[model samples]
Target: MTGSIVFDPLIPWPAIAALAVLALAGVVLALWRGLSGWALRGLAALVLLGALAGPAYQVEDRTPLTDIVVMLEDESASQALSDRPDQMTEAAEALAVEIGARANTELRRVTVPDGAGDAGTELMTALTAALAEEPRARIAGIIALSDGQVHDIERAPDLPAPMHLLLTGREDDWDRRLIVRNAPAFAIIGEPVTLTLRIEDSGAVPATGATAPLEISVDGGEAQSFDVPIGQDIDLPLTLPHGGRNVIQFTVPEAEGELTDRNNTALIQMNGVRDRLRVLLVSGEPHPGGRTWRNLLKSDSSVDLVHFTILRPPEKQDGVPVGELSLIAFPTRELFLEKIDDFDLIIFDRYKRRGILPAIYLDNVANYVDKGGAVLIAAGPDFASADSIYRSPLARILPAEPSARVIEDKYRPSVTDLGERHPVTSDLGDGETWGSWLRQIDVTAGAGSVLMSGVEDRPLLILDRVEEGRVALLASDHAWLWNRGYEGGGPQLELLRRLAHWMMKEPELEEEALWAEATGQTMRIIRRSLSEEIGPVTVMRPDGVTLEIELEEVSPGRFEALYDGPEIGLYRLAEGEHEAVIGLGPAAPREFEQTIATGEVLDPVLATMRGGVVRLEDGLPDLRDVREGRPAAGRGWIGLTPRDAYETRDVTQSPLLPAWLVLLLASVLIVGGWLREGRR
Candidate 1:
């Protein structure tokens, strides 16, 4: 309880001022004239004015509230890195007991955990939330237990009391982490991309000197080790071996006394895209479709297409001598054998065997296909001729044999049941109003799967995989006419693109493949196939648990399912046909949430005013009054600095007196006194 005196004015200040002025004038007149009666009247007037200004004694009952001490405990990933978790747990329990025993003081314990992946710690955020529920005036101090690595320092609340930090880790604790300063999301397959990477030393580093040997690998191949400078980003020029997604793993040798190896390695996945895909186009004769094929391949900024057209047959040469017939000599051996490996893909548009290209060169082309090379054959009616390219040494590699019979009729092309499920030709269309292809060559039974068919359901396109290579045969040369909008056209560009990319062993088009994309702790698992149906998919989690999920058809040939992971780790997804593994969480949980842990991170203003320092180690300090701007405790002691504060429940106010009332009263008094003097 508390008490105080207060004022309750009956008149305004202006009226009181006027009364005082008149009373003073009366006294002055008495003194000037030496009149004792005037002095006596002035004294009485002063007492009358005093009664008009009212005053009263006021008091209120009050009780002091107990001080609230916030004990912020960080159980985040960083705190768990070393023995900090155990230290924090022990320290928090002891502090809570000490604060509870203190007179007029209470303890509020706040526990903070790691946020999502690599977001760091959210200690201050938790503290701010705790502050809003408690009385600000009763706050004594805030003490935080953490690893001093907080992520959300900007959200630190204005604390109402002194804040102190108890850092968790030992003085000798150290860590080695892989730091990637600048990593590109995409790189050219053969061109080197520079990666800025370094080994960072923090806390206590082992006595292995400043330099460390780090191993680097791409696409899970043989790893190469290189000596890297510590604490500085070193430029690493890496050339990708193949196209599509490439995973680059960087690892450092674990120091003998290092705390954990989680930070010793890092994985970076980048897509390997060719700067320009080199392609060789061999055209046998001139046709409207020939120009179409050239334009389609040339339009892609990423494709380098070299096209050659044979305008004159060997027998139709001019009367000039053989040497003078044409200055351009065909370099069959050089293009088909010597430099064949340089090109990523080779396309033959309506091309047939001619006297210019000997059977030996054709054999070289066949060997190229068998040795991981890509070949696309766009057959025309000439494929059925006796001099067809299929009749030469290339016949062994051809997916289909040509029959001399030709069918002339209008037929809409459609994907076969198997073709509809093949990634290359699937999802083309339902053949309602699609653009029409005018011509298609007759092909006999082929070893590969038939992707598309024409009238009477004859094979129109066939795709095959031979040895380590891939091959595709498009039976229609007139397909290009559709690109010219002969009828209602479709996505000709997209169709041809998928076809070309599929033949190049692009991972996305693999017949049987498993892959996944992650969103938070959930993963979307996808299985692509050329088969009509896929068996159940089995997923292996990092915890050695295997789960089977049924895939639903999302597209003509694509199947997918979703998996929510219970923990952060690597997960393997596999269908009956293919298998793939993906890591969802961080290799090691560093600081989760906003990682920085400061007493102010909880309530900034309150912490500053309370003279508290956020310590992640010592936990909550015993509430004690310490001097400002000095060590919180002497030597190894941990203490809280006092905050000077006062609280008042009652407040009183006064008002000015009315001037008219004061003047009227003074006039009456002066007139009455003069009347008495006249009567006497």
Candidate 2:
């Protein structure tokens, strides 16, 4: 309760003051003339003036409210490292007991978790939210139990009293991190692409050499290690081995006494693209179907086609001079032996064994296929004759053997059961309604899968793998009839494109493959195979936990499953002999980017609030009372200010003097003065 004096004047204050002045002057004149009633007159005038000035006593009844102290507990991912979590838990319990013991104080504990996505630690965001919930006038102070690695420090709220930080880590904590400063999303295959990287050490790092051993791997292959200088930018030039998504991982061995190995490794995924595709098209003679093959390869701007046509063989006797023959000599030796490996795919369009290319050159072509080269055979009726190329050394790599017979009946190509599962022909429109072909060479598939058949179910197309290379045989010369819109043109363009890419070993066209696509933390695992039945996929998480996930066949031979990963890191997937590695989120989470604890991030705000930092490793500080605007942290103790906030419950006011009593006192004094003057 509190009390104070207040006034409510019965008349204007100026009028009362004027009457008092005139009465005081009359009394002074009477006293100067030796009047006996001068004192009594002064007493009467004072009494009348006091009645005009209304005076009252006012009192208030108030209830003391508790002061709010906001305590933010940092529970982010980084805080889980080492012994920081234990330290935080202990400090929180101690602070809670101390705040409860203090008079008129309450604790608002806010547990801050890891931020959404890659936002990292959001201590300030949580603090600001907690502060907004309580009254600013009753706030005593703010405290945070953290590693000082806050991500949203700019959002720190305005402090009503003081703010103190209880740091969680030891002074000797340190960490090493691998940083990929610059990397390209797409790099041209077989060309050197430069990537920028740096290795750094933070916190109280020990004395060590200036270089560290770094290991690098592509597509999860065997890693190669090299000594690299620390704290300097490194430009690494790499040439991708295949055209597709290439996963490159860089890791450094964990050093002794380091905080974590999470930031010591980085994963980079880049797409490998081809600058241009080199193709060699060899035609035996000028024919209608030959132009179709030429046009198909020429349509793509990325394909460089080198076409050669044997207009006249060595056996053809011509009576024309070499200069006037309008024929350039074919560079058979340069193309077949010198630069054969330079071509991505070699097409034989109705090409038969001729004296133009010797038997040794054909033998070299077979060797090229054994060493990761690709070949396509588009046969004509000549493939069944004595001059067929199947009779030469090239027959060793061919997928099918010619039977010296040609079917002249018109037949529409049909996809076999195997073809329906093959990537090249699986999604090509319904094969039953395609245009018919005029003729096909009879052949027996020896060591390959027959994808398509025609004319009494004989093999029409066969694909095979020979050593490290791939080969395809389409035993028909009249496919050009379909391209000419006969019987409503078929999917000639799409079929040929898929066939070519498959022969060149495109990753997406592989017979067996395992990969994953990620949208946020959810991953879609895909498995592609030609077999009718497949085993369950075995998934290995980032923390070495393994689980088997059964896949559902969404389409013919394509299996898939969706998994929502609990953590962000590299994931390893395998089904049978096929395996793949993919990253669900960032290679290095933001929490691990700065593992060592320090108060620099929140120092500026703490200083403005007249607070200081206390390391928990030095022992949890004892809580104490401090004056507002004074330092709230010291060597062995932290402090919270006393708010002394209160709420008014009731108010009362009473007049100090009654009006009747004042009038009676004035009349008595006036009469006494009059009687004294009459006696004088």
Candidate 3:
């Protein structure tokens, strides 16, 4: 219990001072006149002044709170690496037991986890939260059990008590990591894309050879190995093979004496697209469809179309000299032999061998189509004549042969039975009200799938895949009349565009293929088919675990499912042999790459607090009472703060005496004494 005095007053001090002065005057007059009751009069005046000044005692009771101890534990991803998880688990348990055992103190345990993305462990944020829960005056000290790495140090709260850290890790631990810095998200196909990467050493890297073998692979193909120097950034240039998403995996063979291999391998997913598609359009004769092909190819920003038209054939000189004609010669040799390979696609629109293109030039064109080149042929009436280009060396690659019979019946070109499911023409169904072609071709045989049919259901459009190349043949050249609003042509532009893309070896045209569309990190995996249903989808996570999920029919002949990834890393989905990579998170989390727990990461700041100490081996220290500014340990640690408080039950208060009676008696006495003293 504790005691203290408090004051309460009624009358002002000025009234009391006036009463004292009157009593002093009476005393002086009585002394001179020798009055009998002089002392009693003075005593009465003093009592009156004291009574006007009322006073009372005020009291209160309080119990001061005890100081609090804060224990912060790092529970981030990095702390979970190596044996750090176990180490932290043990140290936290020991520290809790010690602080709990202390007297006059309360222990507050705080757990901090790794922040999102590059933000590592938010230790300071955790500390601030713990501090807010306790009283500032009652806070004694703070203890942290974590690796030294803290992401939010700038946000650390101003702690009332001294803060200390108990780090967890061995001194000899070391790590090596591969870092990919400036990797492009999208790279052009067949063009070398440069990626900046570095192999870095941390902690106790060995003093062995500096160069290591780095094996890099794309889309899980056989990797190529290279010797790269450690601790320096290197530019790696790689040319992608196909378009769409590509996964590049780089790994270094783990060194024998290396500390950890978690950082040895890294995966980067980049998208591939073509810079431009070069196409050569060889028009045999001027026709309405010839302009349609040129317009469609020229419309795209990424397509470079080179169109050649033979306006006047060499045989059409008709008694006029060849030099006199205005038509320029078609450079067949320069186009077919010289720069044939440079073009991605070669189109022959109603082209025929009318002594204009020799058999040798036509043979060279066939070779071009055989050697991994795209070829498209839009045939006209000349296909039935002896001048048909199909009769030349190109006849072997053509899917259909001319029957020498012209079928001149108006028929609505419709997709074939198999074409209804084919990627090139599947979306276009019969009875779609498409324009009718004025002319039709009579074809006897074709090696490719019949995509479109003419009069009496004859094959009008056929698509085929040859050795390392692709071919599409449109038997009728008059199809372009539909584009001129002849008979309400339905999606003429779309049909021709898809036909061209199909001949370019687009992956979407593959009969059996697996592909996925990305929505952020989640993927909508789709398996398209002409069949009734797709079998099943098998997904492979970055951790090598595979999941087989049944797909649901979302639309006609299209199966789809959503796959949500658990982490931000590369994931693969495969249906049979079809697979694609889904990148969920950043290629690397800049922070928390090193997961070892160490006190060195947290010890420097802890040492700044004089009263703080780390006793990991000894467990939590015993609580004891110590003077302010003294060592935190030595005697038992105090658990509760001592509060000296007391309570008062009753209070007595009153005025000293009556003021009117004292004033009247003092005035009469002073006047009578003064008269007697003056006569004397």
User: Worst lDDT window (10 residues) for model 2?
Assistant: 318-327
Global lDDT of each candidate: 0.74, 0.90, 0.73
Q: Tell me, what's the RMSD of every candidate? A: 4.4, 5.8, 6.5
Among residues 3 or more apart in sequence or in different chains, the pairs in candidate 2 whose N, CA or C atoms overlap within 3 Å are none
- Cα miss at 202, model 3 (Å)? 0.8
- Model 2, 297-391: lDDT tens digits are 99999999999988898788778777898677889999999999898999999998878889998888888899999999999988999999999
> Residue-wise lDDT of candidate 1 within 67-149, one digit each (tens)?
77888887776677666777888888888888888777778888887766667687678888999999787776777776667
User: Between candidates 1 and 2, which one is better according to lDDT?
Assistant: 2
Arranged by TM-score with the best first, the candidates are: 1, 2, 3
- Clashing residue pairs in all predictions, respectively, total 58, 0, 26
Backbone clashes in candidate 2 total 0
What is the per-residue lDDT of model 3 for residues 1-680, given as tens digits with 9 covering 90 to 100? 23444333345677667767877987788767787666666665555555566433333344545557787888876666566667778877876787677665567877887776457788888887878877677777776777667767778676565666565656566777788888888999989999999988777666867888999988877889999999899998888889877888888877775566656778787888889999999888888889999989989999998899888776664697767777666677888778889898999998888777778877877887778898898988888889888889989888899898787877788887777767777776454578777786698655878878888888888888788888888888876776787766677788888888777766766655677766555778888776776678888787888889899977556788887776555677777666766656556664536644455555455544444444344344454544445444332232222222223455444323345654676677566645654565
Off by more than 4 A, model 2: 1-64, 312-320, 403-412, 430-439, 478-488, 518-522, 541-545, 564-571, 624-631, 644-680
Q: Rank the candidates by lDDT, best first.
A: 2, 1, 3
Model 1 error, position 591 (Å): 1.6
